[model samples]
Target: MSKSRIFLFLMLCFIGGVALRSLVFIGSFYLWFLFGVLTIAVFSFSRNRTALLYAALIAVTIAGALWYGRFVPEHLALERFVGQEAAREGSIVKDPEFKNTTQRLVVSFPEAPSERVLVVARRYPEFGYGDIVRVSGTLEKPEPFDGFNYSAYLAKDSVYFTVSFANVALVKEGSGFARGLFALKRKFEENINAALSSPQSAFANGVLLGDTSGISKELNDAFIATGMSHITALSGYNITVMLIFTHLLLAQLLLPRTVVFWASVGIVAAFVVMTGASPSVVRAALMGLALLLARHLGREGSVLHILVFAACAMIVVNPRILAFDVGFQLSFLAVLGLAYIAPWLEAKLKRIPEAFKLKESFVATVSAQAAVLPLLLYQFHQVSLIAPLTNVLVLPLMPFVMLFGFAVGALGFVSYHAALAVAYPLWLALSYQLGVIHYFSQFSYAQIAF
Candidate 1:
């Protein structure tokens, strides 16, 4: 078999194993028995290269299952503490996620360092990442609701239990690289709020940093109704847009492709860090970098392979994400659509105007939306009827929105007045975008819930 095919086949087997183990429990004994069977089959098929390859695939699949099983014990360990009232000390592992009047913190206990417990605390008396806090509350496992497997979703991050209304006391303030990153993010958020009003500032923060904590429920629903929430999710779509915009703008200055590539890489890396390197953003940034490398090598045809390789690489690191992380799944599907489905869409869209590359952008938007539509329906059970039109209208402006948003945010670090000066144009762009979203969302059939 060709090397590329061999690589793809093996990856698919591994992914299959992970997915299987995620959906169905496979005990260690059964896994080992299957491995031994595959071993014998491998020896039996040694006379035929193709047969040997098939046997090797089965072995890799079993290995993948075993890999996932290795983490099952960690999850089980966390489950044991559920329904118990305990006082535990651990550091806040990530920045607090605020929603309405409460903030959610992922706390890692020293006794069970491998697992995470979600702490729901009041928005007041805020806590930052890496703070050692003593939490006293009843531990509870996340329960599935409304057909959503909340437990599986949290499992993607190794979080199995939750502590609601916890009495959390700060034992020590966090000081480290992660704490610094969170502090920097907070400063940028403050600057954004200082420069713009409520919804606009919230929108800027959402699109720029994937921080939607400030976006009100009404405006957020409008975004959802218009199928524009992905713009704020910091998925591959946003990162890809930033990379392409940077590459093209820099290319216009007649810079070397190599210089443009590295410069773009630097910008993306900084953006990822500025966004606090959340898993979704990190995943998207990695894919963006892979795309840049592929383009630099003039190997665009190999992008699908690169995409699969990137995904499998991530899956290898955290196997549960394959089956549990909705963000990761949607991001992968979006890119897959762009690579495999966008070309056909672009070719068929010849009648559309090419000015400002409208046709190309439309093709990209539609292809990506199409790729993720099924998952959206399955997960959300709601369909945005006007999604295509709204996306085509809004996507063309995202590059500008992101560019100006970043400029204003960076200026805020220097002077609030200086940032405000630039915020006017951003405010105009955001108003126009928001207007489109809310206006379209008012249609009688804008979206339909199943």
Candidate 2:
């Protein structure tokens, strides 16, 4: 690629990403701003026809996609039923019944009087994945909380209502697409859960498999206090872990390149299923796939390019995702921070020990924090002042914890005693790390309110 083409590509990618994220906070004007930037760049760099053409194509595509997304029917309508009663029949699209006292269900209606509605049901019947049920209840829109906006949350998932069900009855069973996806998600959860046990393990499973059912509020608070909460969610860490593990596994096998490629693809597929295939997980999986493919093709992969393609594909299919998706924004911003800012900082920190060489890891953590800080502050109104230090100390141990935990879990199935042998060491290491986090968190100034 020509230098000008590369520059234009970078510009388009940057602007497009910012635009998509801005949709959640500032709305469509971000899309307009992106267009304006592209228009100016195209004119300013008119000397390079190829560069200009590429920039224009990207600008138009993004702008068009945003425009089209606005008109698509909302997934669930909460407005009409506020303080009103409605009896609706829907199938639970997700695993309904879980170990948690509270559960989330994505219900789909056979035929809604209006568009389908997403309900956050509370204190209802025991339901599992693929359960078809009719709910008679009142639906209402969720109001915004403190600094966080609820409408965007609903919009991202295309959910429009929260329902308090007076009664839910099991109807016909779910089939085809719903059943298949649910079963796959359940199996993945089972594997991860069976592999690890404990509050920390529960948190890891959430981070790796999107199963937060087992995590308690106290553990969640501990994570937040230590700034390690991201480790409990499906984000870049899980994707990178999956990539490293897959590369290692594939390398050990003497398969042909084509066969290896397919095998790698299969691993990602399995990982996606194992992780509940949340929007963020799916996004990371796509990016991981792109990185793998770029390596296969011998192209110098740009994180920006991979991110843009993934965002475009996701938005095209579900435009509402841009508006109501916290995971989408967090995933995009965290990766963007690593891509754009982490390298510059790493270059500056080159004199550090090779093991700690990339103070860029710290920079990556800080950059991701910066990108999401506003949202975090807006939502929680408190910041962990010691997050940087805590992350630096704790992050190094994550891969070990995940690897050992995964191995222990996998082996436990064959020999319980063997798994315990592995778990003992892993648990000791985790305990020490947890102690460090707790110790630091107790410092007088560990956290500061915004």
lDDT of each: 0.83, 0.62
Deviating ranges (above 4 Å) for candidate 1: 74-80, 348-363
TM-scores, all models, native as reference: 0.94, 0.75
lDDT of 2 by residue, 249-352 (tens): 56658778778888878766766664456566787767557656755666545555666667667766665555456566666666665555655776887777
lDDT for model 2: 0.62
Writing each residue's lDDT as its tens digit, candidate 1 over 299-321 gives 98888778889988999899988
The candidate that wins on TM-score is 1
Scanning candidate 1 in windows of ten residues, the lowest lDDT window is 356-365
